[model samples]
Target: MNDLEDLPEKNKIFESDIFIKILTSPREAFKFINDYNYEKHLYILLFLAGMLRSFDRASTKNMGDNYSIWAIILISIIFGGLFGWITYYIYSALISWSGSWLNGKGNTESILRILAYALFPSILSLIILIPQIAIYGETMFKSENDFYSSGLVESVIYYGFFIIELILGIWSFVLCVIGISEVQKLSIGKSILNLLLPAILLIFFILILVLLFKLIN
Candidate 1:
């Protein structure tokens, strides 16, 4: 289906098939979303992603003794929202920077759209929370023995959700590649490089910092 043809009107961006298509087929979905107007969806998408992250973090905490449930919720919202927004800009900037080096012509708007929507998969990571809460109860994650100590089968099932969560995280990266490649007009190879170059540079810079620290000491 040509998702663009069935796109929601300006007043109802969330109601659009273009929104759903962002998950199933990001490449085509991004092309259409980029072609049309969907700026309002960006903040909403990022906020939802933040909430999911907050929920995941909350599930891992022990809300029994000193930690309040309300406090965890508030912290999650504030920290998750702050981190999520910062990450949005960082990714958008990184992709834009990489695009510039690759002879790709795109602006922050397109990069932001791709990166924000790419978060759809990570939002799906919240599904793992149900199993996590079931296993850990409302106690500290470090106190696993006090709750349900690990057995072979229990361990498999418990860790299995985390493995699924990790897979969803990777799936998000895959979607990012497709969305960024299409929006930035980059080939697949260049798109992969565009995504990886940031992490590579970050590691290189960290090593330099460590070497400098050692020399100073």
Candidate 2:
């Protein structure tokens, strides 16, 4: 009972003290994550990601009015949770399997949790949406053409957000590499290999399937 009551405070400490380190000092962050296995906030992170995803999708398609804010959030959480679970499991599984061949060391469960931590950068990326909503306003939610057809200042804001997203995406990938490497007991190079191997295999597999289909035709 006491521990449950204390979980929120403890989580606050973890978020403040540890989560920020993920960007500045990822090796230490991964060490802490591996040692403590802080898993409580994963869902919260996923929920935030969901909200961002929902908002982005709505804005991109200009379907903002199609769903109420609460409805959009709720729907996003459901779909995001489903997709997050599947992607996390698949990515973790690949890391566990191929990562081992690269001399990486980590279990599926731990990798999954670590991968959730990697999403912190993505959450930060959501900051872009604020100005996006302000600058584009109803146009973002009403019509795709209107969203893209921006004035000079609006064009600058749009491209600025795009650049921020790109940087954030790269930051997230780097954090994932560092976190995965630390947990898996792999060197950075090998850790990257661990991460990329599955992707390469998938691409190769798709190419083979395409070739076979063409032959069959």
Candidate 3:
């Protein structure tokens, strides 16, 4: 009886994500996730945009005198829209498979609603990403026929990255599934973003760094 009294209150012992940690392994990844809910999604979209944009720019710069900043920026926007659409599809499929409940509300109807709403951000973001690409694609087209002539090679390379990005995205989406199983409060917005964040570095950082090293050599 005395020991029971000495212990902390059962309610007090369990902090927000603590129960989450107990229920889930690989705790570290999911811990920081609970914060910044919607912001995570924003980062995902931006990081994806940044990754696609940076790579295209790097390739153009490597094209020697044909490089045009205006052209690069414009193309980034178009690719960004495409990346965003892919992100949306993958996220919705994985999140639904995981039995996600949203807005701190746990219900079947809420889960379906969340899936239905994902299109808002995907379509809306394109309004800007597309225009930005249009501008750059125009400059690129005007400056060099190589950019167009090399279209086959470029498509092959882009599609390669797209496949890699999709694989990584699915892996992260599974992480989110593990995360949701325990936390239950897994923010749909954040999980969606986390799915694509790694590509920013994998596609851009690693590729650009290698080029920089070669240039110095």
Taking all chains together, each candidate's TM-score versus the true structure is: 0.76, 0.76, 0.28
lDDT of 2 by residue, 1-217 (tens): 1233344665556556767777788887777677666677777776666566666676666565676544654565577644646666787898899988877778898887787788788778767766665665555566544436668877777787888888887888898888888889988888888889889989999999999999999
Error of 3 at 57 (Å): 19
Cα lDDT of model 1 by residue, 103-208, tens digit: 8766777788777788878877766665665566455333244425667787787678778888888988898888878877888889889888888888999999
Model 1 CA deviation exceeding 4 Å by range: 1-15, 52-70, 138-140, 143-149
Model 2: pairs clashing at backbone N, Cα or C within 3 Å: none
Residue 2, candidate 2: how far off, in angstroms? 20
Candidate rank order under TM-score: 2, 1, 3
Clashing pairs in 3: 74-133, 74-136
C-alpha positional error of residue 207 in candidate 2 after TM-score superposition, expressed in Å:
1.5
Question: Per lDDT, what order, best first?
Answer: 2, 1, 3
TM-score of 1: 0.76
